[model samples]
Target: MKNQKAVLVILLSNVFIAFLGIGLIIPVMPSFMNIMHLSGATMGYLVAMFAVAQLVMSPFAGRWVDRFGRKKIIILGLFLFGVSELIFGLGESVPVLYLSRILGGFSAAFIMPGVTAYVADITSLKDRPKAMGYVSAAISTGFIIGPGIGGFIGEYGVRLPFFFAAGIAFAACILSAFILKEPLSKEKLAELANNQAQSNFFYDLKKSLRPLYFIAFLIVFVLAFGLSAYETVFSLFSDHKFGFTPKDIAGIITISSIFGVIFQLFLFGKLIDLLGEKKLIQLCLIVGAVSAFLSAVISGYFAVLAVTCFVFLAFDLLRPALTTFLSKAAGEEQGFVAGMNSTYTSLGNIVGPAIGGILFDVNIHYPYLFSGVVIIVGLLITVIWKEKQFSQSLAK
Candidate 1:
């Protein structure tokens, strides 16, 4: 138990560093677009390209994690992440940027599923919610710190943030190479090995993820889709609508990240215990939809900021709640389920940015309006979802 706890700490640190590297690039993306003289649609495609690569690779990555162990996959992912960021920092042309995003997506496919499965391997069912909460908090913390730091560093140059992110990711890769150990028990490892040996990846994946699990995956997709649509073009919207610079955008994101960290670390577990995952998910979806809608119509900076805070808080609450629910329903296929979750997320990311970019070209308000509508549809699905099987599985 003590050993598991120790490993969990290391896993949490890795997630923090990984997310930090990713977040460092967010605030600078608009600047990069400007430097390249890219259109809104082009920018959206650039963002989506990363997820496109991730969607293609996630299924295979998940299977490999279960087969090869988590540590090895994480190391490889971090190395790729560092290389991709470095390429983006140094690249001179649009094709090189696309290549960078492709590598970044591939890196995400490995890192996200591996970290999720690693957490599941080490934590007990009762402790899983809190563990997931901590993981979310770590991710939020990275995002919280990343943009502010990135913005400050970006004062030097747009490419500086990417280079800085590369440095952090490379350092994390080295740290993880030495510190991270496989968290699965020998019995559990043998079970996974035997399962892999008996069946092919697709067969096992299809068999493991039941119908209810598909619904869970769908929910994750909708959440990611809406959020990505809003996020991918957010800086563009703010810059156009409010005459905000990169520094101002960075400040807004920093505030949002602060609220996200607070909610994830302190309120998420308590809220889950109070409302249950079903009710919590439903409530958050409604909140997200309303906030997105309000942000679209509102005029002033403060009103926008206030509404966005609610949006960020809702997203923060929803992530850990939904992840815990999915992890509970995963049964013995933790790695595969986590991979599927990442796959669905990547799909949303791909579609969301593509749609958002086109909409942004037409009208600045369209992306937020579209995001709100999609989230409402997601809410309706969640409201009608039959959770009996999910509940029964979690009870075990």
Candidate 2:
């Protein structure tokens, strides 16, 4: 295979398995928590721990990717992920599950940024969005398959899903060891090394704390807040509102994943190509806001499922487009820009489930309403930013 195609395959496969590992447990988490007598706050903490570890380790992981190689970092991530899954499957207690989540977070931290950087390294600026769209498709495809299978297995036992995750991770490790390869030119590595040696981490951290960072951070917060609520509590809502079970919820999610993949593969790339990233981002945010609001109002499981599919489609499209936009915004500083974006995303993941859990503690509807409001706010900001950028470009 050509190097670029091979890289794409490897990265796409990496996200597929990684997310499959995560999704394998989704259908069982709430029930398992109930069986273990865990509270909403505890669930929130367990989920947040995973994101927090990713937040802490992402920068270092990105640096390691640049220093050593993408192949090495990805292999390391797979190992951690496999180990975490194996430990979690032992099913001791809530505390053990939390510890496993922390371990998985570090694994995700190592793998995700490295894979993204590898994609950026391989694809030209023009094709990057499309390449990223492919990655999104892979992830959703995994979600479609993983949760569908997991939901059935979870009916028998929750621990079985985690065991499945461990097996997948182990297989992924073997596949990656044989298949993944580095593509960075020697000149690129030397330049990266010299820059890293001369760069001050404090300076970079301070810079990432600026207004742009805040804007991007809030955007991710809005996106993740909506998503986490929908993912974590929507099944419960469907059960209450329409008498759906875990299998039914899994079916809805599987259908949603199909929409997600279709939009990401077919629509997202073309929309970005035609409208450009800034305008496409505005469109996605607006669509997300509308879909999420509608999802909250819908009562029937099928109706809710249909509307929620649109929400996932918009979100899946926007993520890669937004990542490319943020990369361009940073200009010549891909590492810092990517690292900052990943950090903010991790922050959102940390905040998202906790906030959702709190609202779920009140009324499930509260989380959806809050998420819709945030999505609208995010859309407005992106629209304004797009107009400003357009004016600047026209003047130029």
Candidate 3:
């Protein structure tokens, strides 16, 4: 038990540092565009490129995690993450930025699934939700801290945050290399290897494509799609619409992340127990859709802030609830399932920003409006889903 707790802390800390690097660049994106003389579509592509790399790499990364062990992959990913951030910080050309983003995506593909699967390996089924909550809170807390710190540093220079994030990621890499231990035992690894020898990747993937798993993937895609669209154009929108600076954008994201952290830490586990994952997911989807739509039309900074807080809160609750649902259903394929989860998320990130960027060219509000409508569709799909049907399908 003590060993498990120790592993969890190390995993959580590594994840926090990794995500903080990602978030640190968010507020300063406008500056990046200006410096690079990029268009909206170009910037969108830059953001989407990271997910594109992740989408392509995640399935394979998942298999590797299960085969090789989590600790090695995590350390390698963190080191590469630091390198990517450093490249972005130092690069002067658009091509270099693209290269950096692609590397970042690959790093995320390894890190996200490894961390999630590691958590599942260390935790019991009954305690999984709570453990997942802490992981989610750790991620949210990084975003909470990243933007505030990045915004402050960004005042000096836009590239400064990237350098700072690079240093942090490298520090995490060193810490994880020394402290993080593999969760699986030698006997368990031998068993899994023997099982793998008998079966194959295609066969395992086919088994994992159960109805509930499909629903979980769809939910992740919808959630990521909506959020990415909103986030991709947010700084630009605020700047154009309200004359807000990077500092203002950072402040808003910081506030929203605080709400997300609070929900993930204090309310998410209890809510999962109370309403159940299905019910809570449905509720959050509805709230996310409404809040996103309201954010588009709302006037006043405070009103927008309030609406966005609800959006963040809904998203925060939905992530762990859905992750818990999927992890419970993953059976022995925790790494593969987590990889697929990252794939779906990457797919959403890819499509959302591409479409959102094009729409932002037409009108800034269009992206948010489109996000709300798409989420509404996701809500409808959730409503029509039947758990009994999923269970029967899986039983086969």
Candidate 4:
């Protein structure tokens, strides 16, 4: 138990750092765009490329996590993540930047599922809500801090933050390779490996489409889609609209994320038990849809900040609630479900950014307005989403 807890702590740190690396790019995006002389359409493609790569890698990553063991996969993810950041920092051409995003996407595929499955392997179903709450909190904390630091670092040089992120991630990768032990024993690992050894990719996708899990997965996709659409050009939007600098963009995101962390750390687990994942997800979608629309029309800095807060908070809570629901229902197939989760998320991310980016170039507010409509669709779907198996599967 002690060992598992310790391992969970390290896993939490890994997630935090990975997300921090992601957030670090946010504040520097406008500068990077200017530096590269890129258009909004190109930026959209760059962001979409990440999801495109992740969508391709998720099935293989999931199977590998189940087969090769979590420790090995995460170490590889960390190393790749470092290299991706390095390339992004140094690259002068658009194609080179695309390559970096693709590599980053692959690293994310490895890390997210491996870490999620490892947690599931160690925690009881009853304890999973608390466990996932902590994991979600770490992710939120990174969102809170990373941009703030990145904005500050960008004042020095836009590329400096990426290099800094790369160095830290490489160090983390080295530490993980040496210290992180595989939680699953060899026999368990072998069983997991064989379970996926000969499985066809299309068959696995078909399996995930079972009525039991399909609607929940759809909601996951919509959640990612709406949020990514809203966020892909958030810094650019703020810069164009209010003449906000990187620091200003970072401040709003960082402050709003702190609220999310507070909720995740203190309120999330209780809310899961109180509202159940279904009601909470519904409530959050409503908030997200409304706030997303308001974001398009908001007139002032504080107003944008306020609306952004609600948007971020809704998403922050929504993901964990949905994850808790799915974890309860996944039974012995945690790795498979985790992969599917990532796959769905990547799918949403892929389409959202491509459209959102084009819309951003056409009009600054179009993406946010589009995001509201997309989330409204997700909210409406919840009315018909039904899952009877989840109630009986877990006592909690």
Candidate 5:
């Protein structure tokens, strides 16, 4: 039991470090834009580049987690994360920035699946949800805390936060290499090797189109899309519209994350039990869509904070609700399902920020209003989704 608890700690730490790398650069993006004399479109593309890299790397990374073992893959991912942060900090050229984002995305693709599969490999079924919640919190809280750190760090030097991020990521990578162990037994590794056809990314991507999974995957995509649209341009938007600085953006995001953490810890499982994943998903979409639209019109920093907190709250709930829904359906095919989940998420991340950035270039408020429209489309899909019979079919 002690060993099990220790392993969970390592897994959560790995998850947190990976996401921290993502949040570390967000608040400082406006600074990067100014330094490069770039536009909102470029900022959006920069964010998309990471997703593009993750999209490209996820399939191979999924395969490697099984073939190479989880511990090794995580170390490789952390090493890449540290290097990516270093590049983004020091590199002056626009192309170099893109390269850093892509590398960072590759690190995310590698780390998430490795950590997730490792958690499942070690935890008992009864304790899985609790363990998974901690992992999810680590993921969300890491990203939330990152912007605050970056924002404050940016006060020192716009580029300093990245260096700090790199140093921290490297430390984690070293710790992981020395401390983490493979969770899977040798017999299980051999079993997974022989069953590659079942867990392969290509196979899962192809199967993701089944009516039941397709609707759920669509929800995931829309959630990613809407959230990215709101977030990628947020610092830029607040900077332009409200004349807010990196410090302000950091504080707002920090407060928003607190609300999300509250919901995630105290309310998440109870809501799942009471309302079920499907109903909770639909409720979150409504809140998300409303908040997205509200953000467009809200004045004053505090008002914006309130709306942003609700937006964060909706998305925070939406992610886990959908994850639970998918996990139950995944059954023996968790590996494949995870890859497909990342694929859909990456596709949404790639498109949303690209489009949101373009729209922001045209008009600062368009992205928020546009994000609302996109999420409403998702809510409509949930409204029409009729999965009761399909779920029963799987039972038989």
Candidate 6:
């Protein structure tokens, strides 16, 4: 394969492994909590705690990825992820499981930004949306296979899937050490260093403080928020709202993952190019808000599944475009931009479920309604933020 293609494969490999770990846990989380005798609120706490850790570390990790290098951070993240998986696999109780997720969240703080930063390093501006689409596709593929494997293994034992997940991370770490090279070289390093000396970190930092990045930041936050909110309470919703079994919930997610894969791989690239990133984002948020609201009203498993799948389709379509737009707006500071965005996303994760839990306490449908409102805010932001105008300025 060519150099760019090779880079693409390695980055995608990294993303697939990273998400596999997540997929391994997700299918079993509700069941696992039950076996350990945890309450619904405690389960929500478990999910929020992880996001809290990620929010705390994201900015620092992102800055380091920019200043030091993507290679080291990627390696470091993989190692931590491997360790976290092992901890999860060995855990005999809820506290141990909580501890493991904390470690996993920290690992993600490095891994996610590191992977995207590396992709940004290698891909050209023109090809970036497509490259990011590939990354999203890799995530979808991982979710497809990982959950299937996890759901199968979950029948035997939940812990088994975690062990398998750790092994995948270890294999990815080995590949990273051997197969991937620093895409940015010595000349780029010198340029970075010279530029770093003259560049005002504070001034540049101040620029990212504008309303545009803030709005973009909020968009990601709401995306994460809406998703996490639903995910935290979904199993309960499946049981109480529709009288659906856990297996049925898994099937719903599986079907949605199929749609997500198709959207990301087949439609995402074209949508971004055709509509531009800003328009696509606006469209996605509007569709997502409607879907979430509709999902809350639906009672049958099939109706719920179809609505959720449609929502995920829009989401998968939006992701690459959003990432590309955010990266472009970050100016020369990819790491900082990625980090701040990730942090806001983490904050959404932190708040979304907490709010969902509260709403779930009152009424199951309320969480979805609240989620729709959050996405509405995201939609408004996308409209107001002029991504094309921003990119043209960068070109000048």
TM-score of each model, paired residue for residue: 0.96, 0.91, 0.95, 0.97, 0.95, 0.92
The clash count of every prediction, one per candidate, is 0, 0, 0, 0, 0, 0
- Model 3, 318-350: lDDT tens digits are 888888888888777787788889888999999
Per-residue error for 199 in candidate 2, Å, reads 2.9
Best by lDDT: 4
Candidate 5 residue 44 Cα shift, in angstroms, is 0.9
Segments of candidate 5 deviating more than 4 angstroms: 197-201, 387-390, 393-396
lDDT of model 5 at position 154: 82
Worst lDDT window (10 residues) for model 6?
196-205
User: How much is the lDDT of residue 222 in candidate 4?
Assistant: 96
Q: Please give the TM-score that candidate 6 achieves against the real structure.
A: 0.92
Total residue pair clashes for candidate 1:
0
Q: Over the stretch 247-284, how does candidate 6's per-residue lDDT look in tens digits? A: 67667777887898887877777887798777788888
In the range 252-360, model 1's lDDT, one tens digit per residue, is 8778888888888788888888998888999999999999999888987778778878998888888888899889888778887888888889989999999999999
Tens digits of lDDT, candidate 2, 1-396: 376786798789989998887777777776776678876656767778888988888777767777777778888998899989988889579778888988888898887777777777778777778888888788888888888988999999878898889888988889888887676767877778777786665666677766555456567666766676556666656665676777887888889989889888888878876997767777888888888778767777678778978887888888887776665555445566666666777777788777777777788687677777878878877654645654343233
Worst 10 residues of 4 by lDDT: 387-396
Clashing pairs for model 6 are none
What lDDT would each prediction earn against the true structure? 0.86, 0.76, 0.86, 0.89, 0.83, 0.79
lDDT of 6: 0.79
Q: Return the candidate ranking by lDDT, descending.
A: 4, 1, 3, 5, 6, 2
